[model samples]
Target: MVLATPVYCKYYSKSVPYEPVRLQKTNLRFYLHDILSGPNPTAVPIVRPNQFGALVAIDDPLTEGPEITSKKIGNARGMYILASQGTDLTLVLYVDLGFTTGEFNGSSLSVLSRNPILENPREMAVVGGRGRFRQASGFITVKTQYLNTTTGDAVLEYNVEVVHP
Candidate 1:
């Protein structure tokens, strides 16, 4: 006698925020400290040759503190491409961040950008958004500060401007 095996599968529909708030095109800046590795990491480090990806936690004061465990406003995921020779190498990035407490809690903003990687300061389009940032469209500025080359770690300063209503 043999026993039969059971298989289960599930699917979820596209997610959309409920009664999302709206805002006008405004400029916001923040510093993201990406730790390639540490004792405990809020965001894991991932890197590849053709493509590299990382989940970086937002740092509040531009300095390393206890933000990794608590007080983390939001997180960012960045993907990049390495070109043999070209003017455009950096692909794009998505930033999701907002207030951590009070009525503004849980109401986050998302920004989609497409900018060059090598450029010291470049502009990228803000494609989409969610939560309090619905119907968003604008641009973002990126600046890279190399911290550690061996571990492939660095700090990215982003200046976001968007309009939503």
Candidate 2:
């Protein structure tokens, strides 16, 4: 019998708000388990390098309210997954939201993964609704592990952008 375990990887955005409110590009890199050595027959080697992506949007609506006339915002997220030489594993990613408008407040969004099952065994989520109004900025993230059930480590890379008008 073989038992599988879960691995955790976290990505954080720059603490500064995307100024100039224009389309921009960013990159995020995550380091996995340390390298191994020696002639080990049962040792699993690292195969994947890292993941990368871009954020795209077109005049997307981000905020709307009686006080504010029309504050349209557009944004998209992209991700890349690296290859691995392990058995079966699970990866988890998390996102942190910062500050925004009242309309988006108290509203939650879901984060989808290429490999749904490998994302999270419990659920696929991003931002939370509760306590959103009080928070100036929040966080959001996605997670996924190698395709092996072995107990090893790996790396994760994330790249995003915020386009504005």
Candidate 3:
């Protein structure tokens, strides 16, 4: 499946915040095709642990993009994860230029720890019987960093697709 525009978040210090920072906007492109044949291809059908959420698998080939500036600042590290508002399970499919190497050379794709899943709010009640059905949503987040700087724009591209049983 094709991915949409990524959501960007900036990190700045209140004491000495960086100003006039413009992140170079880069588009990550890729697709995840279902593996129909393989030793355990069918067994790994992109399972979503949360019944109310969805499962997204990002292809490793497309993880290159821009890098966040000011990574030295506290919490300057940026991350991308999947999140959901309802009972649907949210799965982080792919992440752009947030790796150690800081390039989308197809290296950090196996880094699943960086991505996390978000669950629905339990305090709220379900409406329209939709409560029983939980789905998963695919999303990405870019946290505190200089995406666009004088050096250049670090653009990472990757692909993620949803699979359901």
Candidate 4:
């Protein structure tokens, strides 16, 4: 029998783009609740560690104006894994968020991030994507604007810097 071997190659330097497109949106919050039931159920926790799921309605300023309305141009939902890491008791989270509709109507955007959740300003990597955002890769910055403890409702702002062809 002939011996089989594996070969690997590595590159030290990579070319960088001069200018990358930046997308910014403010006053965006995800209303996570069951709509068919009428009025927020107020039974679920806004956030928790480990596996969790919710039906999200993306409230954007352009379409919904400033008021919180049921009209959603798109949907946002994700699964998460949260736990303590290292000696500092840092709350590390693994999040996979999927987006559809609006600018992402036909296609979808998938974001995967493994980072500390306790931080005021957090960043996540755009590992993969589909549709208009096909092969999209970049980083996103998240800022929590508001959080309602009782209803588990929150407002978050996002700044995305991405490279797509």
Q: All candidates' TM-scores? A: 0.57, 0.21, 0.25, 0.52
Best by TM-score: 1
- Clash pairs of candidate 4? none
> lDDT per residue, candidate 3, 1-165, as tens digits?
998998798986667665653323222233212222345331132545553343433322122232323231111121223355454444333323222323332222222333322221111111111111122123233231222334222233233221111
Cα RMSD, each candidate: 7.3, 20.4, 21.3, 8.6
lDDT of 4 by residue, 1-165 (tens): 999899798878988878855643322334332222225432233554343332223322212222246455454444333344443323233333345446555654466665454566777677756666676678777665666655445455555666665
Give me the displacement of residue 49 in model 1, in angstroms: 5.4
- Model 1, range 27-146, lDDT digits (tens) per residue? 766556666556644344344444444233333223222333334445554433332344455555555555454433555556565556678887877766666666667877867765
**How far does residue 34 in candidate 1 sit from its true spot (Å)?**
2.1
lDDT of 2 by residue, 1-165 (tens): 999888797886778665553332222222122112234322232333432222211111222221113342211222223223343332333323222434444333323333333444233333332242221222223233332335332222222222112
Residue 8 local lDDT, model 4: 94
Q: Candidate 3: misplaced stretches above 4 Å?
A: 1-14, 40-103, 106-165
Ranking by lDDT: 1, 4, 2, 3
Model 4: runs farther than 4 Å from truth?
A: 1-67, 85-101, 149-152
lDDT of 3: 0.28
Candidate 1 steric clashes = 3
Off by over 4 Å in 1: 1-23, 41-71, 77-88, 94-104
